[model samples]
Target: MTTSTQPQAQAKRDEHTQPQAQLAVFDMAGTTIDERDEVYRVLRESAEREGARFSDEEFQKWMGTEKHWAIRNLLTIGGVEATDELVDKAFAWFRDELARTYTANPPSPMPRIEESFAALRAAGIRVGLTTGFSRDIADLILESMGWTVGGGEECTIDVSVCGDEIPSGRPAPDMINKVMEITGVDDPAAVISVGDTEVDVESAQAAGAFSVGVLTGHLTKEAFAAKNADAVLELAADVVNLPQVAAQ
Candidate 1:
């Protein structure tokens, strides 16, 4: 593989410039996609369907983890041995249910997503999406939104990184790292990542990016700040309009 020149180019760009964000990465479900809490419901349904007795709290504990990982954890918690076959079966069930339900209802942007996209574009920042959903489902949501990245909108998504695309998902830095790589913004300091979960905040923080948490989804106020989010907003779109963004 060829070594990327992004770092060198970024260094040259930064030499005479104040460090500023060049890209923004946002999460999908609960972050920007309004699924109305159906995801967790489906997770629990999948667990139960596979004969695993995962309670709501137990299932929520694994939020933002890869589906297979979450399924194995649920299986183990419910005293079902997590053999490869069993884990695959449970994850498959969850994925199928998610696809079916979402296909029927599709997904809409969370409140303020359009405003956020507008702000990002006005500031000349590129945008990307990182999500725990697999690529197929993420694509499904994107198509439904008519907001497919790099197409279908004036304020387009430059990249979309789904959980299965990387070695691991949130709480790990891989997704954020991948965004930086593909966007040609080598410095995490020049990136802003916003999401509605602790895993989202944690991933950006671990990657050394500015982590913003939004409360438009499953989290409460104190719970958001507890994630050590660099900033907390009522909506993800408010992030690009922050005073710091203007400086960039």
Candidate 2:
């Protein structure tokens, strides 16, 4: 079953606070925040239109991949012989559907996400967004929520690493490192990486940062643990309730 909301118990994430805590790096799509599975949903439709079919498993694997990589890799793994033209076609379809989905049924923050973000800010922690979303989509999500970059009246994050901005995607520390550079948080120990995949965990570990695995995206607990994450939980919102995350 698709996990829809985070539990209240998981909301008590104020427990693990150190005076020197510097940054909280959040993954978009299914970690710290998300409205719906728009990308996956749209991709499935596009695949069908392209005379290809996607299984549930296949879709899950594609959930948070960078757009270019997701399209290219999906075509490759599916033996579809992807070309730039074909990938562009697929992307065009996805973009069209994305607008429709959001316009009709806009997505909002994942459970406790806003709360946790607020809590982190209140506690003086710098917040950053690292996502596999295309820049256009990422901008939409932030704009829809009326958030700005850098905490002000808006839900400003200190840094945002969009899929289009990075040369390497998840399972690599490039995105996280970008965030650290933006936040000026040199010590990995003072940073916490929250995401929903093995790639996210591996990336955090590669960056020497603590990792929190949230089961809101496409991965399972076992899958997350296999990568050696520091903690496993339900959602980013749940982190707000966790003493381990919220306490400072």
lDDT by residue (1-248, candidate 2, tens digit) is: 01111111112123255335578898887676666667677766776667665567776666666766777767766668788899888888787778777777777778767767777777777888888777887888787876678746355566688877876776667788888887777887787888886667767777767778998877788887666677788877665544545556
Q: Write the per-residue lDDT of candidate 1 for residues 102-216, one digit (tens) a residue.
A: 9899878877787777677667787889988888888888888888567335746788998899877777888888988887888777788888877777777677777788888
TM agreement with the true structure for every prediction: 0.87, 0.83
Residue 76 miss distance in model 2 (angstroms): 1.4
Which regions in candidate 2 have their CA more than 4 angstroms from the true location? 1-20, 151-154, 240-247
| Alpha carbon deviation, residue 40, candidate 1 (Å) | 1.2
